[model samples]
Target: MDAKAWDERYAGTELVWSAEPNRFVAAETGDLPPGRALDLAAGEGRNSIWLAKQGWQVTAVDFSAAALAKGKLLADAQGASVEWITADLVTWTPKAEAYDLVLIAYLHLPEDEMQSVLAKAAHSLAPGGTFLLIGHDLANLTEGVGGPQDPSILHTPDKVSAALPGVNVTRAERVRRPVTVEGEPREAIDTLVRAVRA
Candidate 1:
């Protein structure tokens, strides 16, 4: 969905996604000492706020204005300091080699666009900095559950790894998340990639 559609989705009073940070995001960055962090396509700034609580200086960027507005309120209420920006991820260029951690979660797009965004994000990382991406896997449509049906926009671990040409990929594979659907347990497959810039 585009920014306008996302705005309408976030227009309601209730939260669209959970207030907590993504499980993978927390797991990967937990052990690392807090530093400058950037979250691209940071809807509602859930992960960004969490990073702030963990003592990281965070910058959250998303295209949806309504989502960021809600995020600002949530950050304020939580007393977390974060810098929020509104911009298109495909064209938004972050400062080069300035971040200790750069995270891109569930930002599904076409293959070329995804590669472009990932490359830019990887480039923003300082040496030894972490770059993590988690998203609905391409195989999820056939093997897993609950994600975008469009095959073109789905992510693959290999694709994400390929995007960060020179980076050291520590992890690149499909991970499963357990969820309940109509009282029945199900697993959702997602692509996970964690790399370190050198």
Candidate 2:
């Protein structure tokens, strides 16, 4: 979907996504010292606002203006300050080595575009900065639940790892997330990667 489509989706009276940060993101950053953070494709700035509350100076970028507007209200309500930018993630470039952490969550794109953005994310990280990505794994199609149906846009550990050339990959694997489908409890397969720039 394009920016216009996403705008329309986020223009609803209620939020489409939860206000909480993703579990993987919280788990990964909980122990780190607060610093400058960049959240790409930050839909409604849920994670961005969470990061701000955690004492990180956060910049959240997404293509949808409506989503950012909602995020601004959310941040205000939570007493969190976040800089929200309306731009295309695929083409947006961050300031070189400016962020102490870079987060990309559930931003599915074609393989080439995904790689390009991952490279940009790596470039945005400062020395010793962390880059973390969490998204639907390619195996989620049959082995998991609730994700984009298109396999081409789905991610894998190796795919994400290979995109970062100058980083030490601390973790790159498929993780299981418990979810309820109707009434039966199930696990959703997700690809996750955590890397640090040298």
Candidate 2 structure lDDT: 0.95
Output the worst ten-in-a-row residue range by lDDT, candidate 1.
Answer: 158-167
lDDT of 2 by residue, 22-95 (tens): 99999999988999999999999999999999999999999999999999999999999999999997888999
Residues 80-104, model 1: lDDT tens digits = 9999999999888999999999999
Off by over 4 Å in 2: none
List per-prediction Cα lDDT, in the order shown.
0.94, 0.95
lDDT agreement of model 1 with the native? 0.94
Clashes of each: 0, 0
On lDDT, the leading prediction is 2
TM-score of each: 0.98, 0.98
